[model samples]
Target: MGKSQLMEKHPTGKVQVRAALLPLVLGAALALSGCIADPQPGPTDGGNAAVSTSAPATGELPTTSAPLETTNASNKAPVYWVGRSNDDFFLYREFRDVPDQENPVTSALRAMMSEEPLDPDFFTPWQNPKELATSISGKNVITVDVSADAFNSNLDADTADRAIQQLVFTATAAGASAGLIDSNQQLQVVVLVDGHTGYLGFDHIRLGAPMSRSTGMVAPVWIIDPQEGTELPEGVVKINGRSTSPGNKLRWRILRVEGNSDKTSYLSGEVTASADPSQSGIFALSVNLGPGKYELRVSRILSTQGDSEVNVDSRGFVVR
Candidate 1:
């Protein structure tokens, strides 16, 4: 068969090309499904402590602390951010100090427009959409009102699509994190220009409809735990993250990156990390290492495609 086309055109002259969803790669990325318990037994002294490499026989992750306590770094709400690698944009998360009672969806959007991303690789195509206003109407639809100046045309069609997606993803993420919406229900977002719902997105994609996240729009893997540049007093650290691949276990590796060189000392071999069978949940692993800068890479082969690193997440950190 000929190549299939997924395209949409705006009333003006812009085109939105919806990329086809890549087949789910088995055991791909971080399949976060369980709770992160306190750092398990590992060598804290100068001796290299062997990290726990075994997954408990029970598929159910160890339960500890209340759901509220599960929130990373206090009760700060989660705000999704957009990171670009090559020509693709992937979704990332960052916590904000905004109170849980406050409208975190709005707070997150404002932050997305105002602050620079903490991740150096991530960036936004936004220029601080002016006078941004957000609200929830009807049951679970989020509406964002902004001026035309927010629709800067400095980006190409693809980048602009990701930018708009960033807004939809962040809004829903904030809403869910703030307890304003339920996971069993659907949440959607619509953009309005100066009180009208027919505004154009950065790339001229029509913003009149309520947008929902689709499988093709997200990064295959993400490292949600031990935020980048985190300084840990202990050598043992718990790593957590989320993924889309369906499998019982994923692969992980820890490497001591040589300064200003291509060389790296492999601390952990091809270790397997247990994942929740539900696809996206907390996947935890305990690792012990001496004080130094290290890079952690979690990856999986594309079961759908040929053998290759289809989805991977790498984080760099320092131990003191």
Candidate 2:
């Protein structure tokens, strides 16, 4: 069958076609894979109906945002979403609170499929499956059984590849974060549709094989702390995040959100992320500001002459 005719067989083919054409029409501003940026405001709290305010006691899994302060918990688990940086589509992660009873891996996948990311710029194309489950073998292989309905979204080859990695990254992160798997060992994921193998994923990629994280799939830079829509007391607000390729230095800026969409630069500087070969690029800085909405942006310095930067990551916050 022809590409267009083949796509038409899927329920969401038209929507996927529009999404694929968006980047061509809007250029870098709307660059993305099958995932499209959300236009709405406010935190989604993952797929959870409500966010709880009470903190879970020590030694217990936190199900609410209350423990965020004392425990320094970002999100209950890491859920990867697709987004664009430097005009290229890549996977970005957001720590999110999943349901209390749900397994970390399952919850993360569920959230990735159904929930909206806190940042409006990030999104996912996976649909929520009616049934989902995960099991980890001693060999560090994670088996994911998801209902076939989760593959409802039609995607092109590139987006399909990214979508698969989204699952791999999220499952492994969840497993390691929850102590269900050894972080020191190599891990792989095998996806099964409706508990059966050999199911085609998004009508593009063949499934039921051992899959590992693909290099160059993740965003080169990502804001890790003071997540989008965070409200902080006036003081020295700490800004920290991860960078995959922190050459020599990274640039940062704080822009105050003035009127509706206007942003006035409040602070700008250069910072260095850790250069340790054994660890990913980690950087931190602190800035004090008065009560208002602000954005923290970071980027890799590509060149010293003129203005050349790439792989930007930013987050919006409120200084209370």
Candidate 3:
């Protein structure tokens, strides 16, 4: 399809001709899933954690070139950020409120490059680009055109790869969540720098080729609700998060912040994620507490033979 045809198909806005040439790649299947759960009051010591086992939905791309109307009135979109767990870095996500005028893909990329993550542990190496836009083809390929300034951050090869995958995951998640793309098919993302290809990313990975989500790029465990520095009511506090280790035991601890950097463990226990291998690891538990500053830490329970290194995610919040 040509630029004029893409514009005619998407009448909502004029298509920005940012790329001199668009590259196409074979599509591969990619599965993206998230867990949503309502917290139910349970024992604080060791309660039955709620798990979401909902099946993944497959979406069909609209036949017409017109832009797909999104029913997500909340204006919230998913944006992935890079964070460290143990010695390795991984991608973490946050659902941010975006402008309604922008499509999910654009909103997500802009946020990923410019916005700070809700969790202090998460950060983005991407500098805000002076120009950025995104378009999706019928083949489920998303093309992103961004300014070269976005790659200003200095990073090693491995970190650069994770940073690029951060964009891929965010764009795909945004499209899937908005029902703008066909989720049943494999999706790929191609990034362009200032209407051209072959731009080196972070002085490391070369751009222009189609990229998909890389394995082991996502954090093993992440706290989804009660984000960092959130304030909650002084009653039953519900904690929710996701884990990559499904059917595995997760150890959780609630620490009371005593000083500027000191945290004394208040409550600790273990909860098992859903045993169903098909479902994403969604775990939820609640604890009643009085008003105070606290932190929630969660990590997988490794066996004796496993490496001593642990991957953990923690969120600091206040109960008022």
Candidate 1 Cα misplacement greater than 4 A, ranges: 1-45, 53-75, 84-87, 98-102, 258-263, 270-281, 302-307
- Sort by lDDT, best first: what order? 3, 2, 1
Expressed as tens digits, the lDDT of each residue in 1-320 for candidate 2 is: 11232123345343252134213211111110010111122222222111111111112121210001112234488888888775556777778888868777898899998887898877676877899999999999999999988878767777777789889988988887777887766788999998888998989888999998766676767788889899998656777666654234567777778769798766676665443432334456555566778898887777665557777888999977
Cα TM-score per model: 0.73, 0.77, 0.74
Best by lDDT: 3
The weakest ten consecutive residues by lDDT in model 3 span 17-26
Clashing pairs in 1: 32-281, 32-282, 32-283, 33-281, 33-282, 34-282
**Clashes in candidate 2: how many?**
0
RMSD of each: 7.9, 11.9, 11.8
Tell me the tens digit of each residue's lDDT in model 1 across 1-320: 00012234546543343443323222223333432223334333464655554342224442211011122335565655655322345666767566344366777887776666655545555556667778886578888887777665345566567678778877877777666666456677888888887666774588878887644455556677777677776557777765454343445666665667454645543433344443344466677777877777766555455645645667778788
Better of 1 and 2 by lDDT: 2
Global lDDT of model 1? 0.59
The candidates, ranked best first by TM-score, are 2, 3, 1
Positional deviation of residue 288's Cα in model 1 after best superposition, in angstroms = 1.3
Model 3 lDDT vs. the true structure? 0.68
